[model samples]
Target chain A: MPRIDGPIAFRGGGFAPSDRTWAAVATLVGVVALWQAGASAGVIPTLFLPAPVSIARALWALTVSGELWKNLSVSLMRLAVGWIVGTVFGIGLGLAVGLWSVLRSPGMALVSALFPIPKIALVPLFIIWFGIGEGSKLVTLAFGVFFPTVIATAGGVDNVPRGLIRMGQSFGLSHTAIIRKIVLPAALPAILSGFRVTSSIAIVLLVAAEMIGAERGIGAFVLSAGNLYDTDNLLAGIVVLSVLGLLVSWVIGRLERALLGWR
Target chain B: MTDGLRLTVDGVGHRYGGLQVLHGISLTAEPGEVMVLVGPSGCGKSTLLGIMGGMLAPSEGAVRCAGDVPPDCLNALTYVFQDFSLLPWRTVAGNVALVLEDRLSRTACAARVAEVLALTGLTDFATAWPRQLSGGMRQRVGIARALAVRPACLLLDEPLSALDAQTRDLLLEEFASLITAAGTTTVYVTHNLAEAVRLGHQIVVLSRRPGQVRDVVRVDRPLAERRAADPDLMALEQRLWRMIRDDAAVAERERIDASD
Candidate 1:
């Protein structure tokens, strides 16, 4: 085994862990500097677009007002509920199609036709059926994410090497046993990719559904602020959305590494 | 080992599209014996091994497993594939554990995995992924997978063919010793005559594609009868080669003449 003499750090980053930490700090400052310049030079309008400082002030005020957390919690709840339901159905449908050729062609046809229809287009119909509450929002987001996850997962399952499954069965593994142990593990990397992709889709849909109709959520807050012509608060919501996206993507990356630890 | 295992191939044949890949191939691997199938490339030797392993069903006839192990266990018959069929997703230990997953209990599985990992000198590498290993280590993992199963009979589909000469010798030495320790009834398929000579208790030579059993060339000589100095094994090699190479020439001529 190779000895871990030191930390695995990037080339020419120096030996200090603090150097890496300081670099991140510098990057954030640079972004704030760029935003300040853009706002001051009128590349961004003062009334409609807040400077970095003003957006931060808006964020601080929103936090103090408890509006940011309330909105964030609602949006996150919708995303989680939608993503889970979507992923469960997607994986189940994917396996059904992959295991049977008769299912494969019909299943693919369904995905192709249904996948392209803009999910948000159903909002008015959803509003009519379920009212402008969590139900409609969750269903819309779930519908948006499910097909892509199903398609990706099914492709992964279909492409699992026949030799491994045969190995499992030759040892007298029952059909269900083979699926639970061998097939799932074999398809994990691809399935993880499906979940990752679906979560992002869920995030996008969550924001859209909120913007369409909701009392509190980053999206709804931004949209309402726009109606009230509170541009700085609207920009503050945009910043919040971008930060959430970055965090989600980073966390997903870490989860991928941990799940594929064997690989 | 329950008198070893016997393979009774009764006139098995297979056709693909308009072409026959194997036809009327018949041979018997007796108990406590090593039957080496030797032929040139594309000679249907591998296809025949596939039939014996039940990876491929014969289009015309059935493969019978007599003595120990059920006929369907022929389906259970595992092969050390010609290409070293090690799964890239599994670690060295995981690949080795694959075959034994059913036979052993959870604790036994872990213990057996540890045993084989040490036996294969993969103890330090139990956590290392298959893709991280060298070709030699990957092939060792393949061998370990077969061994871990503790199958009634073993199949080797020219596993060492992809290896270099030096590594091949070292591996062959280890393989022979290891299988001898386990006392497996093995069917080894190889194009290399020296490997067949070194490993087989009995060598079965095959003709080209749509292969038939040309002859069963027996190496009655014990491991001790193999004289390192006399080039005596060279005689066995030549004998096996003559039987296979001529058939190969005839098969190629028939192919060219057919193409014309």
Candidate 2:
């Protein structure tokens, strides 16, 4: 028999990774500090890339003058209307496509054909059709959000276990009851994850649509600031957009925790 | 106890696409009796169970249920699945309440859910999620959900096949008592010989693919009185093993040959 070495070297410790919130916070803080230090020493040009402190000052000025709320409110309204409209219609059509054979092929065909086309590229076309107003901007965001929401909802519905549905049927559950009780809850985790994606898409399209034609949104403000060589406000507007994304992500996380606590 | 329903599967056969899975199988689950279907893998016992429960339409014949359904019975035929099939999003009581929700008033639904949870010894875990439970506990939830409807008949498809041996043994004793207490006719499909001798009043053995009934063995002893270590049951288990041993071996070899 071969003698083994003391405590045979442990090799199985690592493939499992866990979240460290502190590490994420520390990394973000470290990068901002490094950028601020470089900007103060003139190692990085402030004209092109405004310092974090300068962006903060610009934001404060905008807040005091009430201009930030003016632009932000308009953008928030557009996001709310566009995303809600798109989501309602998307989930409806997605459920139809998932449940029925007649709609599955045609709906998926349309999604596959249109999902890859960039919504930014169609902004000019929407402006032409909807007359360069809120109509055009809302349409752009809604259109961008529609296809992915459809795909996500349909996929979620498709992935529900057939056994669960069969069990529901065996219990003599009504057709609508099976879909509402068994199908919906089973598909929820996927639909919630899809919300995460579509929310980010809505923000991106909001900015693009505003940059093209709107006069009051943050995207328009950022573009105007860039045109006037006001790097401070430009960076400030971008910061607001990033912060908005973070806020939306945090809301979705809370929604998942509440709805999927069983999982 | 509710009067058990008589489930008759008359000349039932089923084919999936181009393949015939079950051929000319006929059996009857009598009122208030356990009918155990035992066979080798690929014998389509699950398919037969599905057909018996009206979950699947057999290609050749029909299934009929004839008996007085209890006034409070929400569903006449209920299934306890091999995988438990409890919704992960619903609590233990909520899963039991699912079939009752549409049929009963809100208070009545809650009452029935509470009754089944207590019956299954799961009253303490009523608010727990399915994922939090062990395999045995999850299947208890499955059985509880089935019982919540006051089902006249139960179609259990290898309910203990997914559990470990110790859990299977423990649940086997519980299942015998549960079935006897409910007095509901049951059609249980499994490959385990011991389970057949232990729970089955009538054990129906089947041949391999395109399965047909090979033999029917009757045990006159009451389910609760039967023990796993009884000499009679052990002898019966050995007899059943001998009956299906050649078929199981041939089916296994066919699997290997097809894969090769």
Candidate 3:
């Protein structure tokens, strides 16, 4: 093969640069346009699903009345608390399981057994055990986030090269020094990726728990609107959840760039 | 401060469960000398080096690092790994600073790091991450890190084996001069006879498994004079090769049989 210093021309057809933002905006706008046209033409019933304009109006009304903010704040607070609790314990236990052979077998077995059970199914049990309040909802979200974090952290630590550890030993590094300097940095990329998954799981469980037994949250508002056949308000609440997901993914993207730039 | 430091492997033997790797291996690397252990594949050279570096305990006999170490010195021995073992998250300067962080003052550590980086010709790439460097450059960083510790003895296990042939040849010369400049007792293991003749003050040849000493050839000539083209060095390489040729063939056949 001949070597060239400048940018290589692509002969094989694969990835190419294009107007990605324009394409995304155009698709979304086209869908809303089609929906509006269908509703105006009376082809789609308004009771089952509202037009985009009606949903936007409902969203604007909620925003101005401060109803949206009230529900959003409560939901965000729950997510923050539950996710933090799960993450701290998950990382702590995961490091233990990964570093010590004694903990590996039992920890792995428990994670495997519990991780597969549907977390939403446990909400009723949580309510019974912790009482029907913030405790149950918080526990629900924490349970959802915990198992995946443990799995990810342990896997990350396991993937660190044995050769690097040996090198640390030969250089006369203490156990604590080796773990802090070598093992943690090597496992960081994997752990950060785990955060992305656990965050999504938290959002899912948060909504589920809120919908089941809560007076103030996006999930509660959406549930009430659906029962009253208020399609515009329901769709508006759904849009809020979608936007929250987008914001979260954007934050994670920035974190990846900041932390794992060496890769 | 590094004077009178010697690494002695006295009757060191090792066995991995049912497989015996080395037996009754004895050698001493004196102050400011490089001892090269050369043999065929699976001759247990690396295992012996591991024992000497205090990374492993021999099943029989002992490894002794005998000499006076300064009261201020934190590490007596350091190793250069064959795999370049550079942490991907750390920059070149960060990797070299790791060993010095515990023992030296912040200002002193920076000075030591700069000196070693300059010695390895890596001062230009101090802030660059390991992933951005080529294999040879990364190994240079590894060497710089090892030298930064100011160890009385250095152990290298086939440190140039992973590089491409041309890069290996180039770095081998750099390594020879760097070792001479450091003037620390060193034990290096390699399968290549040419590397053995070029770098070793004393070249030790070991036979096939249950590896025992076959010969110890002392090269009293200067490192610069031990060139590939020089007749004397060529003769030494040939002599080393002849000692291992029959055992290497036998080891290869046994390996094939074991695999089957």
Candidate 2 local Cα displacement, residue A148, angstroms = 0.5
lDDT of 3 by residue, B83-128 (tens): 9888888899999998889878999999999999999999999999
| Most accurate candidate by lDDT | 2
lDDT of 1 by residue, A88-156 (tens): 998888888888889999999999999999888987788888898888998998888789888888888
Report the lDDT tens digits of candidate 3 across residue range A210-254.
999999998899999989988899999999999988888899889
Worst ten in a row by lDDT for model 3 chain A = A10-19
Model 3 stretches astray by more than 4 angstroms = A1-22, B70-72
Q: How many pairs of residues in model 1 come into backbone collision? A: 0
Error of 2 at A114 (Å): 1.0
Give model 1 RMSD, 1 decimal.
7.0
Docking class of 3: medium
lDDT, each prediction: 0.80, 0.92, 0.90
The whole-model C-alpha lDDT of candidate 3 against the native structure comes to 0.90
* Model 1 regions lying over 4 Å from their true place: A1-31, A41-43, B69-76, B223-230, B246-260
Candidate 3, residue B205: how far the Cα is off, in Å:
0.8
Lowest summed lDDT over 10 consecutive residues: which window, candidate 1 chain A? A164-173
Candidate with more favorable, higher TM-score: 1 or 2: 2
TM-scores across all candidates? Answer: 0.88, 0.97, 0.94
How many collisions per candidate?
Answer: 0, 0, 0
